[model samples]
Each structure stands twice: as C-alpha cells, then as structure tokens.
Target: MRIFGKFLMGLMLVLAVACSRTPERGGYRPAPGPGANPQLGDSAPHSWDGRGPYGQQVHGIDVSRWQGDIDWDRVRGAGISFAFIKATEGADHYDPSFQRYWRETAAARIPRGAYHYFYFCRSGAEQAAWFIRQVPREIGSLPPVIDLEWTNSQTCPYRPPAQDIKRQASIFMDIVGRYYGQRPIIYTTVDFYRDNRLGDMQAEFWLRSVANHPSVPYPGQRWAFWQYTGTGIVPGIRGDTDLNAFAGTRADWVRWLQARLTR
Candidate 1:
C-alpha cells in the first residue's frame, strides 16, 4: 500500500505539470525558438524566414466573401484577437458578407473593423460615401481601413498618377475620418506604397509583406499592422485567409485599442 501511494503521487505530479504547459483558449503564447521553421503550434503551411506572425502577441485575420461561412466562436477561441472585414468597393459594390461578419465577430466579442477596396475608376469621395452608407458608426468598432493597391481588372486598369492617387486617398480618408471620429488606417502593398509615396501620408498603415518582415521591405516606414501571410489556415476559416500581427506587445495592444478604437 505504501508503494502504491507513492506511485499515484508521482503520476499526479506529472499530470499537473503537463496541464500547466497547455495553452488556454484565446490566451497569448510565446513563439517557438528563433531557428524553428514555420510555426511550431500554428496552422500555417508555409515557412517564414525570419521572426514571423507567430512571434507577435496579437494576431488577427482579414476576410471577404471568398472565405465562405466562418465559425466566429472557433476563430476567437483559436486566438484571433481582432478582424477586418471587407465592406465596400468602388461606389456601388458592397460585399455580401460584410453585415454577417460584422455581426458575428461582435457576438464573439472580437474587435472588428471594415475595409474599403479602392477602385481607381471611381472618385474617392464617391467611394467614401458608399462605404459610409454601408458600415455602421459603432462606438467600439476598430477604425476603418482603406485598401490601396494596383488591380488586374481588365475593364478598370487605369493607373492614376502618384499625385492623383494621393489626393484621392486623402479625400477618402478625410471624409471617412470625420464620420467615424478616428483616423483611418491605409492598407497597401509594397509596390503601391513605394510608387505612391504613401509614407508621406498622415495615416497609420497596415502593410502587406509576405516574403519577409515588413521592416525588410518597408525599411524605416512605421506600420501598425503587418500582413505576414495570405495563405494562413486558422481553426474556423475553411480555406486560406490573410493573417496579420499588431506591431506591439499584449499590453501595447490593450493601450492601442483604448486609444484608437472608435469613439
């Protein structure tokens, strides 16, 4: 009986240690070793050469109708701290899933924002007005995002001059800013950013750099969010989705939300 009691005590101690190491749902977990390829405990299939999205304390996804139906509860449980959903494009086109995604993310208690995909063929004021009509002016929502990138559309392939692009973007952002009472974030690709000199703009940035860290591609440009991968696989998402990381610690994320979230 004495030997059996000692064996049971040892087993219990082992189980306790194991349980302590298990990550809680929606809790932050440190990344694996620097040399580790890809991400050890993440669902990403592609490998990142440097400190990747997993290294960040706060991770999130940006989605559109292409993602199909999502299980928001599972996404939140899988450690998605926030979401940016596609709301509008051009002057008349609205994403069919915008309302559903907005509603579900809120129900899941995840901070959610809307993004407008800029159409070069349309005037910025028109596009901004379209976005304002579609997205609600919620108090706790994340600030709006304006996606600026070159498109491969055969019908609307007109690339405006750099100065023109900047002017239009400013108009859109300024109008949206007034409506939301928060400065908007500009989401841009590397080529678009460099070509348009977006760094000169007085707005926060969400940069896309999938090959390497944003610092490698963007150089000295400060960024609020870095989209590290577009082929990321998360728990609730059916197919690939864009994954992004906040450029701060967990405490910084809390502070940012307090300061930057819609009033």
Candidate 2:
C-alpha cells in the first residue's frame, strides 16, 4: 500500500509537469520573427510556396469607390496594416469615397495613402496637379502612389510610345513626390510594366501578379509592395477587393514607414 501510494504521487507529478509544458489548443502563439514562416489567413487562399506573398509579414489593401462604405474599424482590427485609397483619376475625376475613407482610416489609426489613376488622355502634369489638389497634405500619411496601367476606355485608347510613357510617368512622379516630400510608388501590371520599361524608373514599385509570385513575373525587379490578388474577401470590405503585401517583416515594415511615411 505504501509503495502503491508513492507510485501514484510520482505519476501525478509527471502529468502536471507535462500539462504545464504543453500548449493549450487554440491558445496564443507568438508572432513569427523575421524570415520565420508567417501565419496564413485568406478567404481565397492560394497554394503559395514558402517564398510567396503569404510569407510576407505585413499585408494591406488598396480601395477605390467600388469597395463602397467600408467599416474602417473592422478593417484595422482584421490585421490590415495599411491602405491606399483612390483619390483622383485623370485631371478632373475625383473618387467620391476618398474623403470618407481618408477620415475613417485615420480615425482607425491605419496608415493611409492616396493613389491617382493615370488617364491616358490627360497630361501627367495635369493629373499630378489634380491629385495634389484632391489629396490633403496630412502628416504621417504613406507616400502617394501613381497607378500606371493600360485602360480599355473607348474615350482614351491612345497608347503612347514607351519613351513617352516613361517621360510622362517621370513628370507625374517628380511633381507628386516634390509635393508630398516622399518619392511616389508606381503601381503597374506585368504587361504595362514591361511595355513601359518601368523597371528602368527610379521609383519604388507596387507590382501586380495574382497568378504567380512577383519574382516569377518581375525577375530581377526589387519591389516595395506586391498586389497578390484582386478577388480578396477581407472582413471589412464588401465584394472583391485587391490584397497586397509589403516586401519585408513586421520590423522592416515599421522601419520603412519611418523612412517613407509623409511628415
């Protein structure tokens, strides 16, 4: 009886130590360190390899009026680190929801920036001025983005020469960058980027490659952001919205923001 009692106490002690060392199911897990595997959570997740955008630590979204009535609080709470709201298109067309998104995102404490969609018919200078007039010079804003892409508008089918496109983009970036005190990011699709030889440009790139990794499509190109999907189902957004990932870890994201966010 004494030996049996002693054995029972030893068993209880071992079990207690094992239970304490083991993690509870659904309990807190430490955030991944730099170069560590990131936790993946996307509604329409891709079968991404270890090097894909899912591996990126910082994720964000770009929104236009099409997203409609966003719940900025939910978006911020959903682990979205930043946003780029469409402010202007061409020289005259302003996105109707730009102001609301800008205000709400600031209230939610999400780092926000504005983007101007380049209109083929409009001069770069004219479009840049329009964007400047529309987007406020707010402190702590992310650097402005110039969205460069080919549009299928019947009103503006003019595809300028590569040299001309480069020149116009340079003009827009120069003006917008000077105004914002940060170099503008150029957002472009694979075709548009190749056609315009945008790789030669002296600017950070936000490359779009939903089907494959940006490295696969944009070989040898160093990118700041990768637009990985256009049919993303984010919690705060209605319908499909574009999803993007920063090119570094959480710490790297903070450092980049410190260096590039508008003062």
Candidate 3:
C-alpha cells in the first residue's frame, strides 16, 4: 500500500511539471520581442503636422505586442498626436503592455485610444466585455477602437459566416457604444473591409492601405484616420518604428481630442 501511494505522488509531480510548459508559438500568437517597422512600398516620409499618404488630415499609430519598449517623451516630441494601444482580445487573453502604454500616453498628454485585436473565434460580446474589463473606465482615455482584420492563424481559422460576422460586430459595437456614450472607431484593412463590408456600419474608420491612399479604391470615402505604412523611423525608439502623420495640422488634432469629451 505504501509503495502504491509513493508511485502516485511521483506521477502527480510529473504531471504538474508538464502542465507548466509553454506551448509552441504559431499563428494567433507571435513570439515576443522588439520588432522593426518595415518600410512600405514607395511610401517614404513626407510632410508632417497634418497630412497623410493620401493627403488626409488625421494621423495616428496602432501598437501591438510585437512593437517593443518605447520612450514616451521621445514619442511625444516626435509630433505624435494620437495612438491606439492594444487592450485585449478573448476573455482570457489581454495585452501585457496595454495599461502601461495607455497611462504613459495619457500622461504625455497625447490623445490616446485603446484597441483589441479580435480573435476569429471570439464572439463580439465576449470581445467587448473582455476589452471593457481590461481597459479601466478612465476619464481621460480617448475613445476605444475595434481592430477587425484577417486572422492568419491555425488556432482560430477564418470560419465565421457573414451573418455571424455582422452579429459579432453589432454585439461589440453596441456594447462599446453604450459604454462610451459614442460609437467606437473601427480599424481594419482594405481586404477585410471589402470581404466583411465592415463599413456598412456607421462608426468612424481607421483604414489601413499601405499601397494606395484612401482615395483610389475608396474614392470620396471620408476617413477619420489612415495607416499608410508599417515601417517608420522615429527617434528615441530602439529600432524602426511605425510613424503616422495626422491628416491635419496640430490644431486639428487638438480639436478632435477636445471634442471626444472622454471626461
């Protein structure tokens, strides 16, 4: 009897040790570390202080786990007017740097917003709730953003139906809208927008079209912000950083920040 009990104890220890091992990184989870902001096609830095690749007036940068440590003062000094920091995704997963960056951005007095990289498998309401829980109901934080882009992962493949997509979007938008008392900005790519028709809804858009500005394919399409390039070089950052120029002048940015009424 004693031998059997000892054997069971050894077996349990082995299982406990195995349970703590890290899973192999793949799609849906990029390895952590600093990332270089690669330069986009023919997209070189041009005028700043209120202009974009498409000549729009609003400028902002979206951050994720890939982008490593940043110096707040350097970013503010580099003419960055606003930023969207990654907040959360599924119920169990949240960005580690979200609150840190959000507080830093707000402390710098930069108009800052929070975003969630939606998982294809997560329901809209779940995503919304998770994000709400992750981002504190802080008075100074800017409006929240929803990043709806393609999922290039095996963990949660792209299998959601159109109706499901719409339902999910509605659930998330409705919750966030009610939470913030205004519609949250929708951040997406050209392909995702065309495939999902995400623009059918009424929220402001932060479009990503690294190739062409918002004018060519989306003619007459007014956008609140544009992400023209992934690769950017900003001083004070350890490596290449994504740089965004506001669509308008510094004054225009201030006006948007003032009007948000975040409280």
Tell me, by TM-score, which candidate is best: 1
Give residue 36's error in model 1 in angstroms.
10
Clashing pairs in 2: none
Q: What TM-score, to 2 decimals, does candidate 1 have?
A: 0.87
Residues 155-230, candidate 1: write the lDDT tens digits: 7999999999999989999999999999899999999999888889999999999878898878899999998888
Question: How much does candidate 2 score in TM-score?
Answer: 0.84
TM-score of each: 0.87, 0.84, 0.75
Q: Rank the candidates by lDDT, best first.
A: 1, 2, 3
Residue 249 in candidate 3 has what lDDT? 45
Candidate 1: where is the Cα deviation over 4 Å?
Answer: 1-26, 33-46
Error of 1 at 207 (Å): 0.5
lDDT of each: 0.82, 0.79, 0.63
Report how far off residue 257 is in candidate 2 (Å).
Answer: 0.7
Model 3 CA lDDT for position 24: 28
Q: Write the per-residue lDDT of candidate 2 for residues 1-263, one digit (tens) a residue.
A: 45534533453343233223312321112243322122224567676655666556567899999999898766655557789999999999999999999999878777789999998888889998999999998777899999999999888899999998889888999999999899899999999988878898999999999878888989999999999888776777878889898898665876687688776
Summarize candidate 3's per-residue lDDT along 1-263 as a digit string, tens digits.
Answer: 35534533443343233223333210011122211111111235443333235333234566866777877666644434467888887556888888788777766655677887777787888888888888876554578888888887777886687667768877898998789765788888887777776657777787776656676656666777777777665544564455454455444655565466355
